[model samples]
Target: MAAAFHVRSNSFPSRPHPQAVHVDEQLIRLRSSESASTTSSSCIGQRLCDLQDLYDSLEKLLRLPVTEQTIDKKAVDKLLDGSLRVLDFCNITKDALSQTKECLNEIQSILRRKRGDLSSEVKKYLASRRSLKKSFQKVLKSLKATDGDESLPVFGEAEALTISAFRSLFSFMSESTTPSGKWSLVSKLRNHKRVSCEAQTANEFSELDSAFQSFAENKSENPLKMEDVKRLESCVQDLGEGIESLFKSLMKYRVSLLNTFGH
Candidate 1:
């Protein structure tokens, strides 16, 4: 029996598994790239996708029996706590994204009718955007407050990276919605010329803001363009989809951790 077992063990060499360090490295590279890149919708969408991929890899690593065995109860508790906090962040982000999309849809609907004045709808949309921005700012503040609290040997690196990514995401969202002096800048640009360098360099949200601002200021002369609304809608749709996927991944990771460590 011993000879047979020994032969079987030799026949099946141990398979190599993914290491936490590898995921940590990927997260680091992602963070570095994100910092250097513009916070355009495309870049943010890609960040969301990359974050989901990292979480998928993390789920696989955590599911490994060897990895789970190495984590003590104390570590598991810490991970669980962190996981819950992340889930909260994910939920809040999803809610905000949904609200923003709804506002976009409402604006598009109003624009489609070629109505006399879109000031009311535009005002509503801008108000919604401001509210969402405030929500994101609050979430970011909470995230910042909890930074560096997690120092677990096994999972601290992953948790820190996750928090950092969320911070970047929320910060981008906040800025995109309500950049400082965006209204003043738009107003100045409108007085000088219809299109300028500033408009060319602005992101989708900024462009949408300018469109709405123009429509509100001079509805009869400068109507809310359907094309601009459509473009903003597309951008928001992509972001919403990305956030939804990331939220699902987070839930999966949290559930897996709970199943493994909740006992």
Candidate 2:
């Protein structure tokens, strides 16, 4: 009877540990997923910092003085070199991003399934990258080289001249609005397109207008200082903001004149 009982017990098939096998597989997947997430997150974080640095460099380059008086070729070249280096770094980052996209996406998917924090960092990286791209485009358009010239084309020169001219014209118009006497510089300008003024107030307008015209004619003079350029740029930007469509037409006309006369 004892031998028979022992034989029956041995005959029972050994049950497979299915639950233990599943738990082990789950643990392995979780660990591999976390490892990949850490690596991708680190790469993205480093790239974001690099992009921010590039943005700063671009801002610095854009803010440099470009007035007729201070547009130094050598100095501009140095800035351009720095900017190009940043641009190159951006290219490298893009390449790295492309290469790691599959791994990043995999990690992203895993994190999303697990409701992880690293997913948010990935989203932030994408947003910052877009912002950096937009900033680079704007600065590039503003500083585009013309006619294959190494230096930025003198696009601002015409704008500066027009701004100065408008400043004078507006001053003279104000005097005309509240005339101390019967005639003023504005009256002369209105009656006969061009006229010389002798009044102290009129002379001030006259001098400003004359200086602007001279600067337009002789761009090599470089009489404009950094402050002068900044003021003119600000004035032009303000007017454009105020009357966008009209400003565009006026700017087109001014640009045409500058192009024809080589200001």
Candidate 3:
């Protein structure tokens, strides 16, 4: 009868007791479900953040295409719901969580290495492209001066030229085909009858009309008066503010990705 109560006096815990293991597994399942919901919520927030970051990274990855950001919807989805290797990742059963972590870590390690290589490859590509561009900077400046409106040997087509140089220098730009390949850019120059295009044409000469007035106000070698520069600066400032807001979102997502995955 005393044996029925269990006679082993060794306080040493045996390998996961069958009943304990069972209970642990159940707990793990429940926790996983709850965490999943939180993770989903976090993802929604993260996507918004990523969208903003995409905006900021634009100037950097301008060659990719504007719609498809560097972090991207896929990466952001992985950050939130994908089988991520998390640190202190699970609070399920000690045994089950430990095993899950082992599996997750192994998987993440492989991906981590691959991702690093891909990033380096992309970065190197950009650097090489930039070097080539610098060799032609003088030629490009000349073209801009004359408003050549034509492509060059190095830059390819006129529109294409803007994107390649803009990507190398400013970046914060592109998607499939490249930034300038966006439907918007293509469409901008598509119809000769577009209202905006017509408006722009009319305004092109407006600057000249203001030139004499500007010269009278303040003489300068550049026909564009101080007011024009001021207006341009103001427009740039607005763009900067939008970029800033987007940058904050990206930073937030980065923090979440790092923390959640135990980066």
Q: Which candidate tops lDDT?
A: 1
**Candidate 2 on 1-263: residue-level lDDT in tens?**
12211211233235413432332343333233323322211122222222233233323323322221233344444334433433443343344334334334443454446545533444443444344445444434433332123322222221222222222222321221222322221321112122222231222212323334444456357342333323323322322232232233333433433343244
Q: What does candidate 1's lDDT look like per residue over 97-205, in tens digits?
A: 7787787777777667755346777898888878888888887778777685634333565566668767866876666544432221221211212222232223667
Q: What clash count does candidate 3 reach?
A: 14
Best by TM-score: 1
Q: What ranges in model 2 sit over 4 Å off?
A: 1-68, 107-263
Reference-based lDDT, residue 93, model 2: 34
Better of 1 and 3 by lDDT: 1
lDDT of 1 at 118: 62
Native-to-model Cα distance after best TM-score fit, residue 166 in candidate 2, in Å: 45
Name the lDDT of candidate 2: 0.31
**Alpha-carbon deviation at 177 in model 1, angstroms:** 8.3
Instruction: Report how far off residue 32 is in candidate 2 (Å).
Output: 38
lDDT of 3 by residue, 1-263 (tens): 12111211133145533433433343333233323322111122222232343323322322222212223344335433311211111111122223323433333343455433422332333343344335336434543464443332111121222232222212111111121111111111111121221111112112322443344345345332334323322322333333344345434544554453345
Q: Give the TM-score of candidate 1.
A: 0.76
**RMSDs, each prediction?**
10.1, 35.0, 26.5
Give model 2's TM-score versus the native structure: 0.21
